[model samples]
Target: MDIKDKLAVDVLVVGSGIAGLKVSIELAKEGKSVLMSTKTQLCSGSSFYPLKASLGTQVTKNDEDKDLFLQDIEDVSHNMHDKDMAKIYIEEIKDRVDEFEEIGIQPYKLSDNRKACFANHGRTIYMLRDWNKIRENVTGILENYSNVTVMERSVVISLIKRNDKIIGAFLLDKNKELILIQCKAVVLASGGFGNIYKHNLNPNDVDGSGHILALEAGASLLNLEFIQFIPGFTTPKYKTLFGEHTLNYCEDFVDDSGNSILDEILPEGLSKEECLEVRSTHGPFTNSLVSKYFDIAMMKQIMKTRSEEGFELIYNKALYENESDFYTIYLNWLTERGINLLTDQVKIAPFAHASNGGVQVDHFGKTNVAGLYAVGELAGGIEGANRLGGNSTGACMVFGKRAAKDCLAYINENSFIEIDSQEELNKLNESMKHFSVHVDHSLTPNEVIDSIRDIMWFNGNVIRDEQNLLSAIEKIEELRKSFNISQFVDNVKDRKSAFKARNFIMLSKILLQAMLERKESRGAHYREDYPSEDERFNKRLFISLNDHELKLEFK
Candidate 1:
């Protein structure tokens, strides 16, 4: 079970999502020995179930200009993105997409071979197929590469840095052994922190592991306050199951209690009044509320009335059955003729989905440190304040590849630094023994996790004020203190869950502290007290965490 005696590699890649897989495959193909690790199964991360396809570089008749693409990115990023680093990404888009196509990713194209416009310019592209298929195909290519070793159920506990240069990582192996992986380069492609909220569409393990690891390694984090909130799907029962992205585009809302609340709040362009008339006599639950926040208590009361009076107060039936995923199901409901809910307004509420700001990195995915690099959702300052829909997948793909390529290049140029495995092993042994003995079972890890999620969703989500953020920060700190008192079931599975929950609590504190420092509303970091976005506060915000204390500043 001891992993300290294991072999080393040229590059250590964390998280086997699309980003990690693609990058490792590329490096291995170039004859570099690469070791990739994932917290769970290879495809369990965010890339496997991405609701939409990305808009890559525009293929223009005029010379394929990277500057134009960079300009568009800066515009969407609200001028907060690093212009110099973004240039590298913009220039490589077409080549990257071509590489994917060569590997068998067929992107959907317009009839005239023109680009689609999700933003001001026609630059976005869609996949001709599904994401699961894409993930399978990519995984197959990675599997074929002999130089790459893929390790499943391995979690990266921390980065191994000496004198501010990252040389390797400390990984928790499947057998619960601390593995000291000595490598010339390391890449972090772990996905976002969507699971920080009580109700979110993200998977259970999306707890901001990469972000915390980077911060612990001395990487600079930017725009941690800008958490993206998507206005869609109602999870009346459970938070994780609602396909909010799908519901946002498909349904309409109706406040059937005869209150015209939907008419006042629904954004323009949607036919709100037409749906309102249909719901007045049909009952409240008869219509869908597309973007309006629901009162949880009110929804329960309405459901109760429907059950008692047989009034059919709320129904979530689709207007038409379609081939598309959950989002298309609701879209079909709105566009199709047979669905009654389409004629009625659907209720909608904003929930946290993505983090726009994260650890800042350069063109080669290097942080301020020499040997450390961050990829995927953990590497920030690229999306700026608000990330355009479908761009995250592309960002992960583009940056993941770049980080791996750069890491390999660095290894080829420099010699590997010597590391003492015994020293690392001794430290890990002491920590494990301490954790096993001192850890108490007074409160279950799941209970602590659930409480943190509830507090974050209530205070730090959607709209934030100074008072609420301060209260949330205090609660998160208290949870962190109590986490050590919780005891696992003394099994491998239970221990892993406990470790992940503890990491989540630490991450939640970072997010809460960042939210408290930002006073103005911009992109997804809306502040109720400040109310409006301020031009003077347009620069990016940065935070560094040391021993659980947050040092805040603007970049």
Candidate 2:
């Protein structure tokens, strides 16, 4: 690698997702030099995927609604949310949402808005109801700016740190060549770790690289155990997210038998329809918002039909007969697969959807480490244990722009100090070379991913017990020891795939470890061995690495 490959920028935004692009656009419009890089093409991440180009936004009715919204976030998080961060989110969300409208997005209001604290409570709006529109509109805005450089198919390998400040990063470009980016600040807007699971709704490239980047950099991540699993597809032959907006017309959760299983399991106080409606609003089962009975019923049905992968999610006849066209996305998704939502039953199982915890950061998306900011799903504290349906999108926009503002302020206050990179660059080169010298097994990337996915699916999924989790930990640890980068770096796709594979193992270990550490069942993460939610375990558990050793503490 030649020194000419080294490039300097005012800010390096890692990820092409909405959050990263949002931040890059913010800075670039202000005439700041910004380099936005993604492992794949623009709009190829979760932002443009199967979720039908949807993003959540919130518009405040008044100051009182903002307070109610803040309370709702804390309530959804099971009281484990960072209150100070919640305050900032509530304060900035309206302004952040207004920016989207300024960019030409028109959000439709729900016909029957829920209560002020619930999903789509009149305050909520969509960044773009259709996903492709987001790609077109958001990317178009970036194209208009002269100060931004969009680099596609660029894989970031490591962050460059010196004396407690992040100066730059090392990346493997699309050509399999190393490029070191020198920047005053770095914003990790990379999404979550959903792709690591067997059944997921994330892009192929979102294999928890952001989490790994933070972990190896010695930053703390909190509440990583709470992975939100929604009822996603199992019968389409290809996996995609089961749109939760259609849950409004759900007829029944019928078993192989002709009975509605939900009717039998729902507790006395909550009716089956009400419980399902609550879940339909958010898609994930959260004890703080709804009762544990919903998740218990769903997971029990999954276990009952475990041999067949999962059970059916049948739609009501009224759904098809209904005059409204609200379900265009669901109808089209079903009809395209030759399955009718009105007549056919779709197999529904818990799919790895959104991650609640990510790099622990303050209100400004700055991680505990200086100059390293995380936006969107890459940052924790906004969503807490279980995020509401529309909040994640709002969080990303609010924090993404906040990170940009803070990044600019930090750059103005401080100048980049010259540091020696020769030694660190050599070590990186040696590590890459070390893989080639030690290649032994004819190991493939898919095999590594498949093995880890199964472990997470069976052991660390919706309902997990102590024995299964412990066994998963052991097996994953063994797999971790056996995996080598050299086995899959022969090709560019495989090299990026290899990077994703490595992050999957490392992040799954952290997830399972966190799950094992939490004995009580709370929100998305459940411990069947200790089913009760304990008040003593209410605070968030954060983890950091010290000299490669795990350190756990509470915030």
Q: For all candidates, what are the clash counts? A: 28, 1
lDDT of 1 by residue, 501-523 (tens): 66677778778877777787665
Model 1 scores a C-alpha lDDT of: 0.62
Name the top TM-score candidate. Answer: 2
Off by over 4 Å in 1: 1-5, 52-72, 102-104, 112-118, 235-252, 255-258, 263-348, 426-441, 485-491
Q: Over the stretch 1-555, how does candidate 2's per-residue lDDT look in tens digits?
A: 433377788888989776887788788877789988888887657765656434545555578687767667777788767788778877887778767643435566554534432343555454456656656676667668878888898888888888888888888887767678888888898898888888887777777898888887768899888888877767744465676656677767766675776887876788767877776666675655554565567677766566535567777676766555556656775677676765655767777878888899888888888788999887888777777667676777788888889988987777775646687787555655423334356446677789998888878888888888899989977776667776566555677777666777677788888898888988887887887799888889898877556777765
Superposing all C-alpha atoms, what RMSD in Å does each candidate have to the true structure?
6.7, 3.2
* TM-score for all models, in order of appearance: 0.79, 0.89
Q: Name the regions of candidate 2 deviating beyond 4 angstroms.
A: 1-4, 101-124, 236-240, 243-252, 255-278, 289-294, 297-308, 324-338, 417-421, 429-442, 487-493
Error of 2 at 8 (Å): 1.3
Error of 2 at 70 (Å): 2.1
